[model samples]
Target: MASNFSRQEPWNLSQENLQEWFQDNVEEGSRSFAVESNKSMDDLVRFLHNMPDMKTKGPKAKPVKVKEVRKGGSIEKGTFYKDGSDLDCVVVLNGIPKLKANTKTGKYRRGHLKPLVEKVVTALQQASFTARCEKVSNLQLKVYAKQETGGILEIDILFTGNNLDYNYIDDEVTMQRILSTPYNTMLNMPPKSQRFIYQPCLTPLQTEFVKSQPGNVKSLIRLVKYWKAEYLHQRQTEKLINSYTLELITIYVYEEEMGSPDRFDLGEGFKRVLSLLAYKLGGFQHYWDNFYSDETAQRGMKLKDMMKRPILLDPADPSDNVLQRWKKGLGTISEIARETLQTPLLRSIHVN
Candidate 1:
């Protein structure tokens, strides 16, 4: 593990040696993990992707059918960590009416997603995988399969209406509509529910937002993820910041410090990221304009009343403040970030 290098007087190493250390220790490990995990992960994705459309009864709505299964999360974005990696699958259902907004409050109706989730679970069980359902703001089905290496691979399935028709990547109008529709009307719902409801629909854009970054940027993201997993022990608790938030933060730091340079010092970039988290995370707030302009995003933020500390809006979906759910862990994360910045391995790496 790269953590072993920190104990061996890393601060004494020169800048060139520090870069080499990061390359050999961090980048190589991430590459090796991806190589070793690719085959099994690929097989699972193929299996799910090839599954036939399932016909199942909806509890109250008409009989729904599986419209499509889309890939999401780190697997789709290519920033998965070595220690803990899971697949995020979005199951799009047909025949279910689009989520209706309350005429009075304009908030989208809840409790309608569970039936679709239950059907997805039944389909997974029939396909020879152990499946279970749970509700955390939205409906999710966890499907388990045994890997060839004697480990279990867990895939989280989220159900949504057939809302993937729009080309959100290229169509700004579609992006605006999707983000502004339910989100602008419903500011009073819990943050988690607000984000989770439209997550499946926005998965493609989210994957594209991360996947379209430069290779080096993705490498930096992987490095940050490795650090989070091994040093911060973030995998031990769900309350900690998520990998997506970390990826966006890394991208933000890299872009701010290094700009569009062909090549930059990963060590310096990492130090800057740690510095931000360690010293300035208490009031961290950032968003991107990939799908919408900054002015539009600011309006949406105001509409949503996203005034909390450590706010990071999802680039694909401006309505989502990705870090809202992880507030409880911010103090611990800030403390760890501070300690990590002072570590011998990183203390020598400084940024302007």
Candidate 2:
């Protein structure tokens, strides 16, 4: 969807006018794209479920058992963008023990899951799907399946032990352990392997946090995401902010500005989000006690020294500081946000 603001045109639009434009453009576009994307996702999930058990070869080769496959990320949370949209599929494997960090070094052996990843990719190709695997980072291994409809489905196949269950959030001990860990170790070997190994288990909580918001709040999220996409376009070298971080920031802006009101000015919230990004991002710190207690967060912050600037902790997994990797690009992001805030459409809106 196209933004209403332009660089050259200075339009003196009211808050109501901005909201109307957002509804007509941003909200409507998101709904239309979601409808089409959901259908494709349903088909993809069905295909994944029906596939036979895949096997890997080595000295200890065995049939890779499938426990369940989950849908996560924007498509699941309903904050998906039309351009460059993709699904996050977490394939949970049974009988595969979670990899443990070396006690001596306190770091996991890198590429431990390479054998399993290769096996999954082979299975996808055998099923007539064009699949490619890439190790995006030491913590992330992803598989991209090219669709006949020209869209790609990004799958994160996780090998986890039986100990980490879906009800982990209910376990107080688990939550405390997750919260108290230092950021460096957490970044390397995330608690319960939430970011790398057992991320699928945390997907439900992450999805519910955003999905449970009001319609307008979700729309605000979509608006911010669209703005982020447009701003970051053609700037691949910059460490672009992830969609989850943007979603949380949007929610935080709305909650801070409008409280619990069911409805508010969408444009006003958008402007404040830009204002925060442009001016207040360097010292940003946001967390939610939806899954863990605030007391736990406070203690954890003190223990982990996580009170550092730009801490955007994952609500589902406290160990994950979502903004940790994007420190280098904050200046660029702040500059773009400032420019967007000064654009003709947003500049006229009074933020108080």
Candidate 3:
């Protein structure tokens, strides 16, 4: 039977459709700053203000505010359904540093960042919860945990020191500088795309994963754009948006296998991110249930040891279900997903 998919309101990629997508999803009782983020901007602000290092006006101290950027953009939702879903959020910053590049290394390295994050980690510790802060993405520390109020929050505390020179009141100058910053400088990926990369956002990591396989980024981008649009169209419940995003990342990261020693040789912490995101998300089951390709499931459970999870997938035809269809048609989807799935886990999932 031919697919009976109908391109509807939230699933359309046209501007009109995007407006509606934003209206239906974002404008109508949206808790964006809440859902997309694990933590609160306000909490982040307060924590920083209390930082012992930033408390005084000395040779190396600066203050920052919650830099909120609430705007609209589209999401990858695909087929008859591309996507038009937009997003809005407050991009808050803790402390903006005032570091001028040294004559040698240009931008200061770890030596400059340690003091800043250490103070950040210390203040976050006082939150009356079990929180830990560690350097993860570039200059950002992945700090997170559950608080006393039973709220789960994760944050990317960045030590940009990018725009801390409060001496200027000129918006144009500041905006210009902010724009010129390096791509990897402080979870840097916004100000343009309709889709936010950090959250439901397609990332460089995902882009890299896709590079090795079938469909081009445009096609894959379209698929993800529609996933959020259509999924939101169906369910607008709590955290559904975030869930969709995580699923998007999961799908994008799916790969074949990860036993290769070359895994560590990938660009810029690619190996670590592959392992961390996979395990943190949901282990093998995360990819299996959410992003699993029929091939993985069909890796031959009939082999006794391997075939334990036979491929219920229509071996002859892979493109069936939308998600499944993507998996089969676009080999890259599974390739990335497998790399993410087969990460070296501290504890491999068991099926007893």
Candidate 4:
């Protein structure tokens, strides 16, 4: 529940807006994984090892499987891409800061990991590795890669985070300050050089939200990335342009389809989410349970397609501006927490 979100518009990363967005966007469904084929994933793996951290024996972790997208009211269980579709590999990292590449003193980029994207492009230019750096977030970096000839290959290195710090507490027996022993690491640390990083914790509901692909997945993905981008620095995460669009999409879901609680975990993380959750907040259950059913979406949230509209860029007609244009988006209601018969109160969910 240690969340840092705002409610004011221009939609920066605010907890108030995040909550409402989830309610509006997420569909009631569950999601799991069934893999097939992917191209960029391989390159992403190679890219992971190429990072300075791995090169210098820093903490390198394995990539886990998440759910897929949705189809005609069904979860699409398959590889990330099929045929000659482009692919991209990724290495989701933790304990890294979203500080700009120039910030000279952070654990993740001590000038080593900092120049990675640039260096990769340089390497690719020489050795035929086609890649591009797309978006970078607080804890995640989405890099794009593709075949130069006729294919697609884009991998996103989602740098999920856990607090990695070098806090030194005192050892009573030793009568001296000692380093804290952290968990969930594949690398060993010395007392003087302990690592420190920030990790997020999501509720059962929230975790379901992450995997809820198209549903809160897309919206949550925006929250995850946008917050890091806008806030991790001097500003806030919500300030990003995409953040507002994401928030708008969220409101659309909740106001539209308030699905049952359990159904939220339906298909798998991605498929179920994409199919049911995103922009379909009509069916979220305020309570808890597992598994799902069509009956769930019956009593969904209040969602409506608001993004499709006409607009003009006139300052005189403030509504003509980009911000005002979204302000006109239907279902712009923003909420923080909700109350139900169970008196079940809600709190912000943050996970890495």
Each candidate structure's TM-score, on Cα atoms with residue i matched to residue i, is 0.81, 0.79, 0.33, 0.30
Error of 3 at 287 (Å): 38
Candidate 3: worst 10 consecutive residues by lDDT? 313-322
Worst 10 residues of 2 by lDDT: 102-111
Q: Alpha carbon lDDT of residue 339, candidate 2?
A: 68
List, residue by residue over 1-352, the lDDT tens digit for candidate 1: 2355456534346556866776777667656666655655555556556655544334544555666667787767877766645467776777655543332212333434564465545555665434333444345766666555565566677777774456544666666665555544434454334445556877788888898888878877877777787677732455487787888889888776577667877777777788888888777778887776676678657644455767788887666778777778877787777777766767667676
Can you give the lDDT of residue 14 in candidate 2? 49
RMSD of 1: 4.2
lDDT of 4 by residue, 1-352 (tens): 2132333221333334545543443322111111222333444455445544323223653322211111100112111112111122223334343332123334554433444444444444343444455445433344444553454444334333322332212232221111112221211322223222212211121223223435433433433232234332223223223332333233333434434233332112222223332243333223111222222212111112211122211111111122333342322211111210011111232211
RMSD of each: 4.2, 4.8, 18.5, 18.6
Indicate which candidate wins on lDDT.
1
Candidate with best TM-score: 1
lDDT of 4 at 219: 37
From the highest lDDT down, the ranking of the candidates is 1, 2, 3, 4
lDDT tens digits by residue: candidate 3, 179-258: 22321231222222211112211121222232333322223333343433444233332223232233334234434332
The lDDT, on a scale of 0 to 1, for candidate 4 is 0.29
Q: Please list the C-alpha lDDT of all candidates, in the order they appear.
A: 0.66, 0.63, 0.33, 0.29
Ranking 1 against 3 by lDDT, winner: 1
After superposition, candidate 3 runs with Cα above 4 Å error: 1-9, 12-22, 32-39, 54-102, 129-132, 145-151, 162-352
**Backbone N/Cα/C clashes per model:** 0, 0, 27, 98
